[model samples]
Each structure stands twice: as structure tokens, then as C-alpha cells.
Target chain A: MLVDRLNSTARRVPTWIVYAGLSLPAPWLFWQGLTGGLGVEPIKALEHEYGLLALQLLIAGLCVTPLRRFAGVNLLRFRRGLGLMAFFYLCCHLLVWLVLDVQILAQVWADILKRPYITVGMAGFLLLVPLALTSTDRAIRRMGMRWRQLHWLVYPAVLLGGLHFVMLRKGWQLEPLVYLGLVAILLLLRLAPRRKRVAAHA
Target chain B: GTALVGLAGAGEAQEALEPNGWDEITSYCNYYEFGTNKDDPSRYAGQLTTDPWSVTIDGLVERPGEYSFADIIAKMTIEERIYRFRCVEAWSMVVPWNGFELADLLDLAGVTSDARYVAFETAYRPEEMPGLRFPVIDWPYVEGLRLDEALHPLTIMATGIHGRPIPNQNGAPLRLVVPWKYGFKSIKSVVRITLTDKEPPTAWNKANPREYGFYSNVNPTVDHPRWSQASERRIGAGLFARREPTLMFNGYEAEVASLYEGMDLRANF
Candidate 1:
């Protein structure tokens, strides 16, 4: 019944509208920032805030399937959109860090090598690239069942992301702990049942 | 001097931690978006228009008025003071500041009898400031000190660094430079200075009170919420871990420690 409702809604909502609604927020946020609506130093804040939002979206994208089974919110199809948005923000985040933060090529690569957290963060961000590239309908059809297997990289991407946050923290703090807990619960919910089924069959 | 450093020749440049001195501090910086990094501020923030920037002096003042940055710079003679800036995050830098005494500015403002503390506020335009959205610190960045602390000779409002006007990324136009406290205590891109009877909530302290205290004096004893406050990575120096013994009161023990006499620095810190 929920799927039927979602299908009907999806049919009624034009794809262009969906795309427009999805893509408008970032540029709009950036524009509002340029106009000084956000506060002093709009561009810097816009970039950082969007980057944080992107990380949050990556976690949310991973949670969609688990949420559909557990929380009864079957917004699973939105995962692709959310995932794409995450990659978009990651691109922007990387660009800003490179352009504004590093401002030099030699130091940019040096920072990635020298800082452990940056290394993990870059790993997390880079892992999303293949997933984003193979997200298209044609790519999904071409890869067949392997498409699902390939996309499993999202799990490690999210894991590395949480590790990035933890490693950046010098001491135990509740924020990173919260992200870690959510990831653990997500993995357990998806994998623990499969393990139990295999054991029962044996 | 040994009582401060425990070494007879502690002030003498010693064979060191990571080798290269004057290397990292110039390169790595957390100046947010408004100020230039230690090295790039002069290059990038050079074109910043500070002549039109006005500072509003209000709060517990008998006479409140607006003063342009240029006028303020012209009113007082800037003296060169080489001071150590210890960050709350456990990094330290020895910067030579060209600044005027805060006492001169406070006197010009005619601070009232009720004014017991001086609060500073940064420009809140995110369009210009870009980093305001998620300031590794907080919005409307602030710093303050008790009236006595404000009146201290070492509490100066810096206009330039390294004998030239401060670069944009280094809080161009005007900023506070309190040698006795961690570097964050020196507020940047200031637009407002309010004299208040009650202590103002500072940016770092409001973000994490346990880590950032009201009196962020440089005492080797009080550790930050994350790292050791006893010592710091002197940036632009060789090696990642190279460090030197931190001074008590940031080497301003004689100039400023009397204000906290009989008070436990550990508790106050």
C-alpha cells in the first residue's frame, strides 16, 4: 500500500520538478550566503556547512534501507538522490579545501600525507566516486547483480567517514561516539540477521 | 628566569625538538576565513579596505561613539612588542606586534565607573567573513577581559605585525593582543567594544567551557579539554612534535600575574 502511494506520488510529481527541487538548495544556499543572509563570512560558512551536511547525508543514505524495514519509512528510492547530493557536497568540500585552505599544490598533497585524519577522510570521499559514477540506470542495468555488490563500498565509505571524525578528535567526545554508534547499529541490523539465518540453516 | 624555566640558560636558543625553527608557524594556521594564514595574510589581505571600517564604542561608556579604523590607527602611536601567543588548542607562536596600548583607546571612550569588563565583537557579515557559517569556534566571535586586565599595559590593540600593517587574514585594521593569555583571547576583526559590569561570554568559552575558560591565561598546569596546555607546537619550527617549555603567564608573570594573586590559577584557568 505504501509502495502504491509512493508510485502514485512519484508519477504525479514530474521528474524535472524533483531534479529542480533537489539541485536548487545548494546553489540557493551559496547565493544566500553571497548576499550576506547567512551571516559574516558567508562563503566560508556556506562551504563548511554544506560539507557537514553532505557527510550527514551520506550517513542518512546508508540508513534508508534499514529505516524502511525498521521505522516503516519506505523512502528508500530517495537514497540515490541523497547519495548523489553527498558526492556533490564532497566535491565542493574538496574543491574549497584545495582552493581556499591549501592554496598550494605541494602543501595540499603534503597535508593529505602528513595528517592521518585527512588521509582517512580522503579515503572516505574517494570511495564514493565509483558508487556515484555507477549510479545511473544504464550503469545499473549493465552491472546487473554485481551493481549491488559494487555499491557495498558505501558501507566502508561511511565507516571511514566516522573514523575520520574520531581520528580528528584528540580525545573521546560524544559527537564522534554518536556517529560510531549509529554506524554499528546500521551494520548489525543488516548483517546480524543474515548470520543468524546462516547458522540456523547449518 | 630558572624559577620560570627551571634552566639557568633557558632563554638561550637550545638544540631542539624537530630542528627547523621559523618553518611551520609561517605555514600552518587556523585563522578562519577572515584573516590570512600567518604567511599569506599580507599577500591576500593586502587589498582589504579598512579605511571605511568603523568601530562602535558602547556598553558601559559615558560617551559612546563611532571611530573609523584609520582614525583610530592615527590617534595612537603603535609600539612594537614581541610577545608569545599560546593558542587554546596547544599551539604557540612568538609574534612581533606593532600596536597601541588598549588603555589609550579605553580612555578615549571614557569608560564609566560601572564598566568592570571590556567585551569585543567581530564583524558579523558572513558574505565578507565566509567562515562564520561553521567557525570551528562560533558565530559573532568574541573575547573579553576584566577591566583591570583591559587596563594592563600588555593588553594592546595591534594594528600591524612584523613592522607592517596586519594582513587581512591576520585580523587586519585592528585586533587585541594580550600576551599573558592564549592567542584566541586576542579577538580579531573587531567592530564593537562594549564596556560591561558583567563578564561577557567569550567565543571559545561559550563553545566548550571546560576547555576554554574566561581567564585563558598561559599557565603550564591547566590542560585543554583535548591536549596538554603545559607546552605547545611552536609552528614553522622543524619536526611535528618539537616544543619548548611554556612560560608561566606567557612570560608576562611580572607584568600581569599580580591580578590573580592569591587566586588558584588551576581553578580560574
Candidate 2:
């Protein structure tokens, strides 16, 4: 009975509501950053927070299949919302690093080209560009079967995102390693041999 | 060389205020021997046993033997000094340090006429300092200063902070506090004081010679290859607070600048 409710009326939960709810944190984070709530290094703190939020949403977006398969709860309708929210956070993260942290265009360019961590992070951002562009309903319909294949880009992009976090830090740390581990496990679960891939059709 | 000679006169003195509270001093640190994280020292330095510590005074000194921490403290006259501590990372704090001038200790050791530099070595217990397990830096951290610089009244071997025995996290038993140069030059948890004829290789300079130079004086004009050195963020200042313009020799030029004399700061840096 609960499954029926979730599939029918629950699935009809407005996309605008999800968008507005997720957007609420952006202004709060900006206010904190501007008002001295971010501690000693506010720019660094804000940059880190934004990047982490992006990674968290991306990981959450990847969990839709496992949720449906194991828990018998299909929340596929919110997958696009999660993905768009992740992209929005990623843009904010990159903007803060570029405009606020680095400030100099030459230095920003040098960082992307010279630093291995920045190079990988830029690659992840590049991969997401096409996925975000093709996320619209009209584009998905027009692209048809090709859409699914193109969206597989998210896998490599998410892997790079996790690797970026790990490499950006100075020395070996537990938090970054845990994030990398979660990303790996989620990806491996998707690649595990399954009969017919029911979620692909659904 | 001409420019160096022309700039022989020292800059004017500047005022520096009291340091951040004890909580900030105890919590934040960059002790690579413990770990790279700012809070690692506070979290892990408790494992170090400093009560029974001893410092070996060797090299060109007359007294070349291990002296217990207790004995060293007993022999020295303690005084409180408020000094501005500048880190290479472009952050600063003014801390109240309780210690005697290092010149008094050198006098006690009777430095040999051949001694031109004062080399310092930090404690290296791999088991206690987990960061030592990694090659983050060459173990047993080393730093050095010119003889004149070491003998300066400003150079102190700190025993305590804020009138309390220095916490294990803040280099408990003993540490050098050379207010003019960057923080790393003031080596922490000192275990050895070697009076040497030649300039000693510092831990950071040895690790990355290009980035970290031997005479790491705070010069705002000469920017680090990675970042600007023109300004510094004051610790305990609110996050959004504007970074203050960095001072040459960290505003201690009035006292220490003449020591460099005609030497090129860029080359020596």
C-alpha cells in the first residue's frame, strides 16, 4: 500500500519544491562566508564546503538504483533534481576558487595546468558539461537511446571528483579516503553482473 | 650588492599587540613532526614525554654533554617577553613567551671561538609523533641561525607561555623563538644545540631548497613562487577581516636588519 502511494501521488511531488529547498543553503553559505562565520580562512572554508556539497549530491544521485533494488522504493523521479543540484554546487565551488581564492587569471590557469589535483578536478567538471546540457526532457527525448550511453560519463566524472578531494590535501587523511571508498563501492555495485538491468528500462 | 649596501640602515620600530588567547595558542599549530593538519599537534602531541627530556650541547661548545630539562630550567633566569610570531604560510600571532635569552645559555656552554652558527635539532620519537612514520620531512628536524642572530637579546629558548608551562602541543620542554625570521626557523621541542663553524642545513630548506631558503626572514617584497607574501592574515581576527600588509623583517628590522649588512637578501633568502 505504501509502495502504491509512493509510486502514484508521492512521485508527483513538485520539482520546484526540490529545487527551492536545495537552493536555500546557497544564500546561507554565502552569508556565513561574508559575515565572518567561516573562521580563520573564510574563502578556503567556503570553497571546501561548496566542493563537498557537490560531491555529496553526486554520490546521492548515484544511489537511486541501489535504493530501488534493495529497499523496494523507487525514487527515480528525484534523480534529475539531485544531478542538477550537484552541478549547481560544483559551479559555485569552481567560481569561488577562481574568483575569490586565486583572484588572478594567470595563476588560475597555471594551477589548472600545473597542479595534478586541479587538472583532474577540471576534467571532472568538463565531463559533467555534456551531461548537464542533455538533462532537459526535450533533449532526452530527442537523443533517445544515445542519452543513456552519454550519461555514463557521470561514472568517470564522480571517480575523478573523489580523486580530486584525496589529492588536493597535503598528506594522507581519513575523511578523503572514506569519500573515495564510498565512490568506489557505489560504482562497483552498478557494474556488478545483473540480469537484464531492469532499472535501465524503468 | 650596491642596493644591499645602500639599505644598511634599519627600518623604524612598529607596535605589536598581545597574542590570541590560550585556547587559540593550544589548538592551532603546524607541527609536521606530529602531522600536517593544524590540529594534529593538539590531538597527538600528548603522547610525547617531555618531563624527563634532555638537550645535548655539542659541536664547537666547551660544554658538550646532555643536560636534563629540569637542570637547564633551574640554571636559567626566566623572563616574560611578548614577541610577534610570523609563519611562512603568511599568518601571524603575537604570543607572550616565558624564557631567557639564548645568549645566556651559549655563555653557560662557553661557545668556542670557531663557532659561527647555532644549529638546533628537535625531538624525534617516531612512536609518539605518528607523522614521523611518513617521510613528510627528514626526521629529527633541524634549523640554524648566524652567531650574531643567536646571541641577539630577541633570540630566546622558551620554557613556558602565558605564565604556564608550555603544553606538549606547543613544544613543551623547550623551543627556540627567533621573532625576526619565519616560525620554522624557530625550531620547536629542541633536543640539541650545536655551535657550528659552517651554516647548518634546515629541515625545510633541505627538503625543498627552491621554496624554503636558509635565512627565512619575513620579506614582503620577495613573494613565494606559489603565493603573495605582501600581506598576512592575523590569527583570531574574524575570517572576513582584511589581510594586513606584511612588514619587512616582520617589523623587527630596527633590531635585526644590521646583521645582514651588505649581503643580498634575495640571494640569502
Candidate 3:
């Protein structure tokens, strides 16, 4: 079948390539930031870009199941890499906000408590931690079925990430709303009857 | 030190000790009509037509008429005024604006005695400003000032910046510059001015009243619903620079504080 052939082909492609490809934007952004290419408040520009990129990668990781089921294209081999990269970018985003934007460690806690967007974003990051740590093949072998259950946390994490973006914007914005809708639709796709067909195949 | 000395020589003290570079000022702008991103305005605002502009002066004014931009400039005595421009978003810049006081324009229009407020409106061209297509702000952005505030010597109707005609991204033809209030209060690319007895509706206030108050004075004490207003990052400061403590009325309190005397700033803010 085409699905078997595609899965074999996707597996041959080294997953490290995904990491190398996704990592390109960081150096470019750093260069732009250092050279005054980022217009007023470079740190803010950098932080925003990192956060948005993380959200995009998380969405891409979520697309793997829907794509395999609906289109018979298997990118499951690269899914773990995509998820880890997303977590990496999210860490960069959080660190930038903490070290550069806020600076004061004491105020960071105050901000997390006071600001709804920060609270939501921090919650999202915390939820993603277990998924990222358990992304290894060894963890999958050890945890077995329990591993999949824990990794399901990606749904709430991605949703909270989208909600964090929406809450941070100044007013009613179209882009953030669209992102939230996309995340909702991706999550809804997983709850469909096709899940039973996939489980039976497994 | 050199930059301050040059400004001091020009008799423009009380300017930011380190004024923003001309490139920084021009490149970074928050003209929401063009877009929300700071870079969006500089990229798109060039398409905006500023020539052959006319401002409709109406309401409680005796000499109500559409005054051409050329005629207005010809009639007014223009001079350079260095002022601190503070955004409600807790960022600021010291800009050298060239224009006449808003009081001069009010005088020319012959504001009626009953008029208590001066309302201003920005040009709303959907074709030029793609942001207008979205409901980011009410089209034809409206802002207002109290009559006394309008008449304040520091309140200017700016036409130019950095010793040249104001760039399109920075409100090309004519823009109000209420130095003591948050930047949004200084409505840009003005097309209409109305003197009224009642307080005029402002764009930000109409959008989110809970967050953006009608009287968006630069008070460090009163915070925005989501963010602290106690400190602001100076625009030209490099990436590693720290935020400086924001001052009351953005450091113009000595000049404009009495205008709000006996009023509750917390409530108004």
C-alpha cells in the first residue's frame, strides 16, 4: 500500500534533518537583532518571533496524526523532532521574556501571578515539559501505553499557547483568533471515529 | 553630551538627554491606520496621499470652513518645538516637531465661547491604510482635548519633524501633538476639527474603555489594565538597555499639571 511505502521512505530520512532545518531561523533572528535590523525594541521583536514560531511548530506536530489518517502520508518519524523543536523555541521565548524583557527575577513571579497571558503561557510551557522529557524512544518503551496518555497533554498545551497569544494582543485581532480556531479544529480532528480504525490497525 | 549641547544651543532644553536617532524615529512608528506592527507603517504609509489636504473646521466655531493645508501653513507662524512623545503602551521618544500651537489654529478658526472641547479626526482611506479594512480601531480615528488643554501653549499642530516635512508614517500633512498626554491623544493625519460642548468619543476608549481611558494622561501611578505604566523604554536605547522610570505627564507635569487640578487622576486615567 502507498501508506506503507511512504512510511518506509519517511523513516529513511534522518530525523536530525528536521532539527537542523527548524533551527535555521534562530541564527538569522539573532543576526537581525544584533545588527539593528529589528526595529524599535529588538528584544520584544525577538521574543514575539520565538513564541509564534513555537506555536507554529506545535501546530505542525499536531498535524501528523490527521495527515496520516486522512491523506495516508506518514510523518510520525519526524513528529517527535518537531515537538522537541517547538519546546526548544518555547524555552527561548520564556527565557527572553525573563532575562531581557522583565530582567528582575522577583518581578517575573509577580508578573506570572498578575498577568493572565503570562499565567496561561507559563501553564502551557509547564504542561509541555513532561511531553518533551518523555519524547525519547526509551521512555516510550518503558512507559508503554501510559506514555501516549501523558503525551496527550500536548492538546491542552497547544490550546493554552493559542489562548495566551489571543489574550496578549491589544484588541480584537484576526490573526490570533484564526490561530485559536486552527488549534481547536486540529484537536477536534483527533476525537473523530477514525481514531478507532487507527487503534484497531495498531 | 554633544547632542544635548546642540539642542541647548537651539534653546530646546528639557529634551531627552539622548534624543532618538533620526533613522530610528522614522523607521519605528505605531500608525495603526497602516498597521499595528511598528514596521508596518513605514512599509505601507508611503502609499498615503498627503498633498492637497484640507481640514474641515466645524461645530462651535464661528469661522467654520474647510481650510487647505497650504493656506493654514501660510497663515501660521511655524517654529521648532522639541517635545517628549509617550505612547500609552509604555514606550517613548523625544521628537523635534515643527509647527504652530493648536491655540493659534483655534484662534484662527474663532472658537465659540460655549465650546468646551476640541475634537479631532484622522483621515480614513481604506485603500491606502489596509489596517482600516480590519476593525482595529473605529475608522476615521477620533480624539479630543479639553478647551483649556487645546489652548495650552505646549499643544501643537505639527507639520514637520527632524527639520523636514513630516514623513507619511509619522502623520505627513497635519497632526496634533499633545505632548503632555499619551501619543494616541495626538490624533494623526487630521482631516477634521470640531469644537463642541460635550466630550468627544475617542477611538481607543470606544474600542476598550476598561483598558484605555478617555483621559490617557501620562501618569506613572495609574497602570494599564494589563501592563505597568510606572516605567517606559526609550525608543533609541539599544537592545540591552534597561527601562527608565516613567514620569508624571511624561516629564511635562510642571507645565501642564494644573490643567487637571482638583480632579481625580486615578478615576480619569
Quick one: best DockQ, which candidate? 3
Order by lDDT, highest first? 3, 2, 1
What is candidate 3's TM-score against the reference? 0.93
The residue pairs that clash in candidate 2, if any, are none
- DockQ scores of all models, one per candidate: 0.04, 0.24, 0.58
Q: lDDT tens digits, residues B60-171, model 1?
A: 8877989888778778988876667777656677777789989899888899887899999877776665444443556788889999989877788988777776766667
Top-down TM-score ranking: 3, 2, 1
**Residue-wise lDDT of candidate 3 within B110-221, one digit each (tens)?**
9999999989999989888988878866677899999998987778899988788999999989899988788989888999999999999998999889888878999999
- Each candidate: fraction of true contacts kept? 0.00, 0.17, 0.42
Superposition error at B22 for model 2 (Å): 2.2
Which wins on TM-score, candidate 1 or candidate 2? 2
lDDT tens readout by residue for model 2, B1-269: 53233223211121336667887677778888888777789999999999799989999988899988888888999988777788887778878889988998888789999999999999989888988887766778899999998988778999899999999888888899988898889889999999999999899888778778999999998766544677776777653445678888887776778889898999888
* Candidate of highest lDDT: 3
State the TM-score of the second chain for every model. Answer: 0.84, 0.93, 0.94
Prediction 1: B-chain TM-score: 0.84
Please state the error at residue A42 of candidate 1 in Å.
30
The alpha-carbon deviation from the true structure for residue A104 of candidate 2, after best TM-score superposition, in angstroms, is 7.7
Model 2 chain A scores worst on lDDT over the 10 consecutive residues at A167-176
* Candidate numbers sorted by DockQ from highest down: 3, 2, 1
Q: Tens digits of per-residue lDDT for model 1 on A30-109? A: 67765655433343455566667677888888788876676555665677888888888888778765764344577568
